[model samples]
Target: MPDRVNDTAAAYCRIWAERGVRAWEEEWWLLARDIGDRIGRLINAAPDTVTMQPNVTSAQAVILSCFDFTPPRDKVVMVDMEFPSMLYLYRRWLEGRGRVEVVTSDDGITVPLDKLLSAIDETTLLVPVSHVFFRSATILDAKAVIERAHEVGAMVVLDIFQSIGTVPVDVAALETDFAVGGCLKWLCGGPGACFMYVRPDLNRQLQPRLTGWLAHENPFAFERETLRFTTGAYRFLNGTPVIPAYYTCQPGLEIISEIGVPAIRERSVTMTSYLIAEAQKRGWSVFTPTDPAQRGGTVSLQLPEAATVCERLLAQDFLVDYRPEAGVRVSPHFYNTDNELSDLIAAIDDILADMN
Candidate 1:
């Protein structure tokens, strides 16, 4: 966690106690606006093209709500390796409205880009895929996906929950329709701080049901008779904001902004490469891609009794997570040292050896 995060969050609480209701208008709301601006800068998006979300699920809900699922454009394309929450949401929501065609990953390790591209056709309306897959950590070529989707008149929604702070992503360069990510993981910010970026051009055309005062152009005018959303990304905003979480999130985003994503990606690739080699030598089944370009910050390992092993590792304060499909995932961030990883592997070696 960022050293300043606790201090920042505490300061936010103090503001609430002392200033009370005035803090919303006088101070807290300004921080809310800055969260959007910072997220816009994170993805190289132009100003006014980003907005805060309590989480990526909410951001996705808004994007999905905007679509009509009309005659020909009634297909939504995704992949088997997508985040489970999103995959489940799409399956439930798109059941009758549209068909969700999920392209299967040949090996659980990597998803073939060609397979995903082949799934996109004239009937497809939107393609929401991960920028860096949660399970395998395979990095998709979103630029290529965007180009292909545009040919068939489909919008692309890129989820960067596993990529934003660790990988280099420029929405302007990629020309993707939307990008969403949260600060919970690499950013060291706990939760309730996520963002979505809308292509400025698409903002005017979309009218999402998930909206509030922030979405209105003239909110103070009280013109409820005719509903009108703002021209740019502000239209994506909905309901009252989460203030304290943004305070905790601000420090992490600022730290990431200071260090930069390119630098972070370089460190991640180098560390993960070394870990992959070490894992292979130890006879562990590595699920993450060996190629740095196709990899993210995580190294997924398939070991016997992964869930039990993960529990043991957690007991020792070795922080890593287990996914049902991916086994135990060891992610080394820029803040982590090479020695720390070597120690982790050494411990894992001992623990697994004991198991046998």
Candidate 2:
């Protein structure tokens, strides 16, 4: 596993060394733009329909703020298990203006698409959902939710942060109005570099709340009163991009693209299945879905001393993320092997046995 990390880093270094810092400069911004376009294509979206943002949170805010919330259509429907940034931002936005109805989940952790869809009506302006629940690794039926929302003339926004590289997604096929994801988690891109896709039809109807020189139609023209915006997804971008962060994502995105999302999804399912089976054998409570189709790459478990168990796992050189309420979360990428999952399970068993 350490060798894999080193190899990944070396691959990135080689690419960056060949490209050089100058390759990421102005006019060369097209390099980053092209990579983003390729990613959109990979997700079955038109190349011209995607925008680059600093992070998913910023993209979510931009999409939410762009809509003009009026009377009956003022509500934004979301699940309670949404990421903290999106949850807080929506709550703050709805504080004085309108209501943000959080649809109740059967379990507090996993959101049922049917329940979420039932909450949407003619009054609903937007429906925001995570493609995969960050903690439980439960994959949502985005196609069904998007179709139902459109029936009521409501827009759907999806946060693909947890599922992008680990699961197969087609933004165009799902017909979502907006989707946001970053390179940090599954994409392996450094923090602060992310991508957003807006449907072409909605491009003209919406305006960016956070405008900057880059979003201007003629950024170099320096016109004060005549601030024209770009026709497509470029309008969503604001300010100068982080060149280093942008460069860092290029290699990772390229790798994912080369391997193909479908293949990665298969590999992830296999890894999670093995992990879950092994954990359950040791009497650990499996929190994620047992079915492959309904799950993402992450496999979560509950233990009496979850925090302590996670710390002990970390000491054994096992890397897994922990959520306070969700217990321990283990996400194995496509690069991770079944042997690694077996080792992880043995470590967990040892930790639990020690507690006993």
Q: Provide the lowest-lDDT 10-residue window in model 2.
A: 1-10
Q: What lDDT does each candidate get? A: 0.88, 0.81
- Among all windows of ten consecutive residues in candidate 1, which has the lowest summed lDDT? 28-37
Models 1 onward score TM values of 0.97, 0.92
Candidate 2 lands at a TM-score of 0.92
lDDT of 1: 0.88
Q: How well does candidate 1 score on lDDT at residue 139?
A: 91
